[model samples]
Target: MKPRSTGTANGCEWTSGTSPLLTIRGLCKSYGTNRVLDGVSLTVRPGRIVGLIGENGAGKSTLVKCILGLVPHDGGTIDRRATVAAIHQELSLAGGLSVTANLFLGRERRTRLGTLDHRTMQREAAAIFARLGVEIDPRAEVESLSVAQMQWVAIARALSAEARLLILDEPTALLNRDESTKLFTVLRALRGRGHAMLFISHKLDEVAALCDELIVLRDGVVVSSGTERLEPEEMARRMVGRELEALYPPRAVPQAGTVLRLEGAFGGSFELHVGEILGVAGLAGQGQADLGETLAGFRPLRSGGLTVQGRPVRFRSPRMARAAGIGYLAADRLRDGIWRDFTVAEHVGLGDLPRYTRRGHVQHAAIRSATERFIDTFQIRCRGPAALVGELSGGNQQKVSMAKVLGAEPQVVVFNEPTQGVDVGARQEIYSFIARLAARGVAVLLVSSDMQELIGLCRRVLVMRAGRIAGCVEEDPITEESLIYLATGVHGT
Candidate 1:
């Protein structure tokens, strides 16, 4: 790839003239008493990639919705060319459709007779997969694909639309490191072709590496925007209106007691220690899910003994696991963690509703107070406790998931990709919260494909390979290179 030339003459990158490919002025959006976006404005020049950074509920999704015409904004002036395509964070593909069919759903290529060009669609989709470094079959059903592959199909759909300006929202949430790097390479090639991109991601390092300009939003408004190089810490501080004192707080030594234990914990083979933040690290689909499910009783353990506080426990169901002081935060928050139609208060108050009930009747005031405390503590942005969980942003929804488990005051917490799809500010907040949990004597088992999240949050990192523990390293000695060696069966130093 040739080195990109910085903006010519006017100190703006990627443009020789004044006209921008996309421009917005005085954008405002509100739903009842909650204002999502307020007077937000931005400009994207052709051939430039702009990174959008903000906390959950800071209006990132709302702004994207307004641009895509998915939602109506109260006030705004958006000037843009006609060709635009967006890959939302959520999977928007129809589950029943095949990959090739979904790629050209509404904008199918037509013959002279107006018939759908099925052959052309299949051939083009194969070429796209080769370019994307993915191995997805064109005839595969959308529901049959993994989440990462589904995201790639969404990208292919956007490219098939011949969009001049492509918007990608948290595109790497479900992808592993190798997959994400490959996607970045594709984006770099597209940038060279003068296609404008609005890249929204929570990973600060990715923004620094890929984006030519930075736009930071907070509380539904653009707090800062310019052609400047801002460090991740500075960017995070601006987005959250405060300095993050520590990414991960110091961990206290565990007390000399066995809170929980798994002996010969062989769904396959491994043992989990109690009172330690056991970091489970591996590539996607490397049997971590099997181990986690087996531990939580979601998957049957063919051979193993799980003891809590020195008493034998048999967890035949999720409820039984929770009854034995164990809580699991699932990876698929939308499917397993939350009921979309349920209100935030109702979700949080679950499992512990008896505390807020008066003589067998639910107390509205008590439930409201409990929900408000979680909102303030977790910084959950919503209309109110009564706001539906589905209405919240991805990060806020994850917060509700965490709140649900913590509200039960469980002795052990297992988090699977806890910070997936969350922004930089929210990531730091979650790291701090998890650290606090460990300090308060709550044993945490963190399962993640992101090595950084593991090394940052775990006290003892356990590397898993082929359904077994490859090695264990104290946090002080862990590094990205060392972790990768263990993950890939390369023998760590």
Candidate 2:
């Protein structure tokens, strides 16, 4: 094939293809009777970023595993000519160690006497960070750096091993808008330098913006593959095998009855009405997350109090909050929402075990039946209720988390970044689910950093800044400009 020349992103020259870095032909993988990947074929060439798009349980993760050699493929051949590395959604860097130490954890430089060579490691780490256009300090603790910086560190570690083909899985799931932009800039720079990348993301707009080519997977097969720039809607359609009409469902008019009210907390007072989708919006670390945590009883209110339907209450723990008809969907699903090792039945039953317990014994059959109901209701894709939560995709795991939350039958639900790492199809499903909750007279406090989510679905939005409610935007047509002004206090130029 002839090489295609693309304009330079930074200072490096960009050419399309030259001796494919990794090639897979007729790849097949399965888990017992269920086929995960079937006859999937793709090629990653240097100087190009390829987007691997798919819905939950569509075999994207399995293809990645097969490439990384984490799992043996059942059939087909993978002809790889270069070193490969992966950057997963969850970072693998040790928090207790310094950036340099974490980068060279397993492969450390050895001195003539065989002592730990901290100085040489720090020097090499600094060099890699500089090459990546990042300014992270090598001697700094990994935990002390920002999420975006840590991602850069992960990329640098991969590159330090002389890896030619890089696999990134949901790298921006934890980053804010600005942080994500910076990450994209660095990635483009890498592309300019002829580094092959397989970028897996649920955010289609991001894939549209960054990828030079698109490979859409559906139902364990490659449905579409091309270099043409496709719209997000078209990509979503190809991924799900249907046209997605709208991302956010129709908004419901909230009732006048107040379901939850907070007094002297979050530097102000706010009331959530029945069937209302009240949005809590702000920049990162600006007290919005704290507001969600406090409402869900993860933390104590310093001097204020909470009232559920006019009944004054102070919750000391999450269990206390649940007992008071409050449910919280944590932002970090893997860490707080769902347990990886636990089954779907166990997840739904752990929080509401009393409903299944009888005669001083936990009823396993009752829990399984209830879990199956949730599986159908949420459209969670899995073998059955006995499937481990870890084995499911990010979107399915999120569905299970939502099922666990709604199982408690709470009057007030606090959804923290409800679609953080979910795909477009699953995101729409979650939006409809939230709307249904509101239609059922359940109040929802949506704490999210996604501006479109705030504008698209919220009836009223409260913007927080510097540990206080900066302003409230209830006007019709709440735009991103208004939210940014309220969030950063930068009005007229």
Best candidate according to lDDT: 2
- Which candidate number would show the highest TM-score if scored against the true structure? 2
The C-alpha stretches of model 2 lying farther than 4 A from their native spots are 1-17
Model 1 C-alpha lDDT per residue in residues 1-493, reported as the tens digit of each score: 0112244432323333444767899999999888889999999887889999998888998898888778888998876653567887677999999999999998788888999888899999999888766799999999999877898898888777756588989888888887788889878877776778999998888888889999999999899998799888898899889877777656545656667676665323333445467788887777777777766779876666777767888878888888777889999898888888999999888846766778888887887898999999988878789999989888889999999878888888889889888877677778878877877778888899888788766667777777776677774757888788877977565
Global local distance difference test of model 2: 0.89
Per-candidate TM equals 0.89, 0.95
**lDDT values, one for every candidate:** 0.80, 0.89
Backbone clash pairs for candidate 2 read: none
Count of residue pairs whose backbone atoms collide, per candidate: 1, 0
Give lDDT: candidate 1, residue 29.
94
The segments of candidate 1 whose C-alpha lies over 4 angstroms from its true place after superposition are: 1-19, 110-115, 130-135, 266-275, 353-360, 363-365, 491-493
